[model samples]
Target: MKNKLFLSLALFFCATNIMLSQNIEIKDDKVLVDGKEILKYEKINFFQHSFYSLTDDEEILMYKYNDNESREYKEDDYFILNFLTAKKKIECGDIQKVVTGLGMSSKKNMEKLITWLLKEKVIDVNGILNTNKLDTFYEKYNENITERTIR
Candidate 1:
């Protein structure tokens, strides 16, 4: 009986460790699954008990996983743009709207995306409009924002 109880407890602990080891990866400003980069913004469903509203009066919990190694900001910029363009293609929404909805509403986030796009040649700087001009472009091209080829 003692041996059986110990085995059961060991199994339970092993199972718990395996479950907890499945952590969400945030690397190179991109999320990964099994080391493959995930390029689109994926919606996650939370349990009701785990869901907490974030309003002005409420403090929201944010997690940042730093790898403790310095990476070139330019390389990060390219990856970010590639990720955003891929996400934009997969999801029919303005980049800003999609990112903001995904809890990346800060100016820094926006800048990173924009800079990445420019660096990657996804959006030509010469023809690129200012941030203020993006609204009009968004409105005009909103209909074309559906899932399409990311050219």
Candidate 2:
């Protein structure tokens, strides 16, 4: 009887460990794996000219925006919910791609991500891709220009 109880307990513990290891509960700015947060550090991508960002434990999280949404890892608007949980900023290209997707995104969502891109200097006040030159004829005549000296 003692041996059988011990064996059952061991099996239960092993099962629990396996289950826990397979689940990751990602919150807004924290990553929880098996109820324990992974070790993380700040990273400043100089090549891309980005500010300090948080990352996962030695892993670059590439979230899928293919629209196969699930409650476990749902899309929290423009930025990947998972990456936000890791406290990392999304690239402009990534944001644009997800933004243009068929998923129904809120106005505030578009404004937030677009505002972030503009703030980060990722995209200028123009079209999507920077490869094309914008025709400034409209801007040269259409836009109202005024000079007001600051006190």
Candidate 3:
């Protein structure tokens, strides 16, 4: 009876560990896996650029770039803006690609991202990002973003 009880307890612990390992949670700006931090979401606004980013234990995974000179929209700006905007359904693969595209930072990309935000009235021309748009976006698709991060 003693041996059987010990074995059952061991199996129960193992099963709990396995289940916990697959659990992902987002609280505030952090993403937790099995209750341990795996990544964090951050926003940066400089004199020349402003953008959102994701950082892992090692390096930045979000698009970060600089371009303070031109006041015009370029091609790169359009691409960056399109990637971040949730105008259409954001698929898992699409997010994966964006996350992987490090150094996607450029003046153009920032411009485009900001431009889209401005166009959608998501943000203002003064470079202030409206959190409501982000909050809404996250509410709708945070699961997909968190899932992609784990992968």
| Top of the candidates by lDDT | 3
Cα error, candidate 2, residue 121 (Å): 1.4
Give the per-residue lDDT of model 2 (tens digit) for 29-71.
3333345443222222211111112332443333322222333
- Regions of model 1 farther than 4 Å from truth: 16-21, 40-151
Q: What's the TM-score of each model vs. the native?
A: 0.22, 0.22, 0.29
- Candidate 2 TM-score, C-alpha based: 0.22
Candidate 2, residue 46: CA error in Å? 34
Model 3: weakest 10-residue lDDT segment is 74-83
- The prediction achieving the highest TM-score against the true structure is 3
Alpha carbon RMSD to native, model 3 = 18.4
Count clashing residue pairs per candidate: 0, 0, 2
In angstroms, give how far residue 142 of model 3 lies from its true place: 5.0
| Candidate 1 CA-lDDT value | 0.33
Off by over 4 Å in 2: 1-69, 72-105, 128-151
Which structure is stronger by lDDT: 1 or 3?
A: 3
Per-residue lDDT of 46 in model 1: 21
